[model samples]
Target: MSIAELQLPPSALHGKKRVLTSAFVGTTVEWYDFYLYGTAAALIFNTQFFPAGSDVAGTLGAFATFAVGFLARPAGGIIAGHLGDRIGRKSLLVVSLITMGAASTAIGLLPNYATIGVFAVIGLVLLRLLQGLACGAEWGGSALLSVEHAPSRLRGFFGSFTQVGSAAGMLLATGSFAVAQALTTDEQFQAFGWRLPFLASAVLVVVGIYIRLGVEDAPAFRKLKVENRIAKAPVWEVLRYHKRALLVTIGLRLAQPALFAILAIYLINYLAARRDDTTSGVTAVLIGSAVGLASGPLWGWASDKWGRRNIALVAIAGIGLFIWPFFWFLDNGPLALLPIAMLLGMNILHDAIYGPQAAWFAEQFPVHVRYTGVSLGCQIGTVLSGGLTPVIAASLLLAGNNTPWLICAYISGLAVLSFIAALAAKDPVGDRLRDSDAHDEFEVAP
Candidate 1:
């Protein structure tokens, strides 16, 4: 289908701004809930959930729990994608937020390792997995919900609201943790301050659900449903027909998860190892990371003006080159590093591309199978790129090369590769929303 042939509703109900707001708020709540777990895992879970061991061993154990959530993401994506395609985007979004909020709250209330022994660890892992699953399904629905409502020319910008939500969520999560830490003594923070953030998510979830329920489903999905065009097996169909898009999505996501993992999660560990600084240092870095969240929507807007490929290439290159230097500055001292760490931690360069990325990938698939295609592709990419980067970075540090320059270069290389992949990809902005038969007719034209 061609751009001229692309059909959209003329009704006021399909207004671009309204859809974007829905997507943005929903995604923000989901991500805020998701990132809170990462923050807690980095700071509190090692002591609270995992058994006593060497600091390294305990940290690894915490990270192991972190990884467990990622393992559940693909499954969540598959299930959420199927439900999204089959039922409706709006309902699934509500479920996603509720699921994420409940799991996070439960984690907050869970018994500590001392009280429950191995059971605490088991409970933490299960909750983390639930968070991952909820997020896995959450993004695709949110992204498509916006993109389907947008004009083709503005899809990139509109779809980017999803990333904006992500940035906001991360900022809020880190900032909340920082504020909570500041309000309480270190002993109090480890004992219960962290739980406050988790419990607070209950309020965000309710707000998100109310906002999402007010928004209508996308016209694209609605049209498909009207025609009974939704795929019976979206996962199998996406894998069979859109394999390249899936692979490309994975390759493109290579930089995002790796960079975020390093800066937000791994950096805390890195700093803790270097000086065993007070919570002030950790809070400083997290606040800096929150500052990084501002980049998402701005970058998304920029991508809409320029090309997605151009903006992504520039961001990737900037991140790759700048991260090495940022790490050098960070290594100088936390004082010297605070600003630099903030610069890098917030993913200033990376967010520009990342902000528009969900829409970029989601636009590649047709409406009928869009959720599955987007969720599966993103999860696969996230697992391969992000899920293991923290472990790798930790291992590298343990091997006596804890230099920022080295880790930056490694992450930057992944960014560079993903940028190259973006260069080779097709721009899906003006493409028609695919009908059911389009998948069967799909072919890779060399």
Candidate 2:
């Protein structure tokens, strides 16, 4: 081989690292901004800004605000996909980071129910919607930045970094809440300590934007541009041609967000309602998230070797079997077992699906419209699962007098549905995404 060819491989490998790291940090910032609200909503928002009535009503209100973010995610995804496909991934990622961080910081500054009454609630909902839109745009861009920049052989390993950001962000958000709680009395925490986590997102956003600005668009996207392969209305193109793949992606995605909502967000409320506290659940989740953050890349690497379909299928099944055991550990715990169940739920069972999702989802569409196709499908799933999950779990608990069996069944049903969808969808392991036949036929708009 020529010396030029030898030099080419190492240079390309180094570039992939730069792109993947930018994607990782930017995604981490977005998720940190997003998950902080989930924690705040569960821990304090209901009492702070919502229409006050009962604890249940307040929680429902807080979570309804949470759902509003998910409601706006599709629009964000559609807009980002359109722009990112034509303009570039790096720019949109920076825009998304700033937008998400600013919204979160504004939430930290907003007045609450005691000061402004219903206007406080309205402001909170609007900010939450803004957060949703920014986040919806963020997920696909960051994930694609990593996956598209990566070599096909290592796409899962590289793509996994975006998933790592999710777990890391959850870890950061949960750990911050734990620290804030420890530093303050319950009343002080409820009054003002909660804002610290939201405020911290500004620092993350700054770092994310700096890093993202240093990177270029992925190789595939650049190639698409060079070939004049950009789609004019990519969302409509996906809807007309690749709708089945989009639907399957949505179905497979439902379980992960629902599981996260139940175990991460709802469990805080569950523990609070059951024992009048969230500290243990927070502690367990903090530990679980840290473990998952570390393990995501390993799972991503494994997906490259083991196949995304096989790994997802097994993990979903594992999640089903572990559901009752998970709650049992929380319910009958000697306290030490609490983290074990959470570790299994978040790090092991959940990461199996999440770690490879970036590569898996990206592979479903062609380079010309990949961002729009993947973003639309994944954000729709988020709206369905993440938005309403805590509300559904909370309602079930209220109906069953706090019995968790019914709630567990609801989550298990989603897992089963997810498994079936994965079974039906094609695995794109080593599939050259740039060569998608489905998109090759569509001519670029004039």
Candidate 3:
């Protein structure tokens, strides 16, 4: 049961296509459920779930509930990471999928504020928390499953499938909303059309659950079990011994998630106020996410060719430089510029960083504690950035008379921080991942 005795046979690695499909499909479903709430919050929840109030107040209330899911994410990551590191990744994936599906479907069925008073809002928040937890648990397991099951040299390319799932999920969410809007009038959409997307998650979840169950656990985890090297207290070990890796993971994670929040969530409200139509913004985002779906694996393949840090640094720099022009296109340019701005910001810039993120973050830790390290770091960073970006950007917009300069500066600052973090982290792509043992002290490569 020693590490050297457990060299993975070719047959053990043969099911990579199945593993990648499982990861991509399952993560897509999870993110679809999670992001549906964000879209709904932007388009309908403000009025549907909260008391009658100013437009800004209602947006803040709905976004506040959206943020609640993020707050619950870290707890989910911690719990799932701990158990996933000990037990297995497949089971956690299945459980998180079911949890998110149930929560989203319930949201579809729940009564509105006008019908049930404050109880409606409370129910919304509670269901959002469940969605958050499910989302938190989903990424680490899915990413690791794909990365660990693939050949080491192709880990970056294969791992990007999970990132593609995110883009696909956003596309699905935006497309679903767009179709619902197209089919229903404004009055009809507000009344019932918004619920269709949430309710539809039930069917996707069944598919995701079945696919996930068919896939085996990662080869690395299986090796860990054969060797009996699983860490007894993975969370505590990550906190005590792997603080720098955790910090690096969090730092590298900041700008991308924040950028995504701005593009995917805040922009909907921002553009709606200007055009007086929400569909335009949703259409723009849908187009951007579609491009993003194609770009993710390309960037990931580029990372495998170049280095993860090299591609990440270039992408982060692109984000910093693109912030000003992004708003310029949105604010001063013609209506057609909206989709172009989204394309440059989301598909090109944000996705370049996200494409290699799964492999890069997983590389930061050894197998025994990787689940906890990557999940905790990723979820914490997400909570700090993605969870708050929309609310903060909305406040900045309102305070600055709908100006975007403050928001631009905010994103630029995060990009700068992330660039420094990526520069500092080591690229261990040429190193053998399995050789990094559980007994060794956590040492980030120089």
Model 3, residue 301: distance off in Å is 0.8
Q: All predictions: root-mean-square deviation over Cα?
A: 5.6, 4.5, 5.3
What's the lDDT for residue 221 in model 3?
83
Q: Worst 10-residue stretch by lDDT in candidate 2?
A: 437-446
Better of 1 and 2 by lDDT: 2
The residue-by-residue lDDT of candidate 1 on 1-446, one tens digit each, is: 21232232344224455676788788888888888877777788877876576877888888877877777888888999999989988888889889999998898798898998888888888889899999888988898888777655566666767877876887788888888988999899878888898889889888888878888886666777777777888888888988887888878888877877776677777767775754545666556545544556556555655667777777777767766766665567546447555665455666776778876887667777888888988887788767777767777666745555556667888877788778766564322332222332111111
TM-score of each: 0.88, 0.92, 0.93
Clashing pairs in 3: none
Q: In model 3, which regions exceed 4 Å deviation?
A: 1-14, 430-446
Q: Could you tell me the TM-score of candidate 3?
A: 0.93
Candidate 1 vs candidate 2: the TM-score winner is 2
Candidate 1 displacement at residue 136 in angstroms: 0.5
Q: List the residue pairs that clash in candidate 1.
A: 292-346
- Cα lDDT, model 1, residue 301: 54
Clashing pairs in 2: none
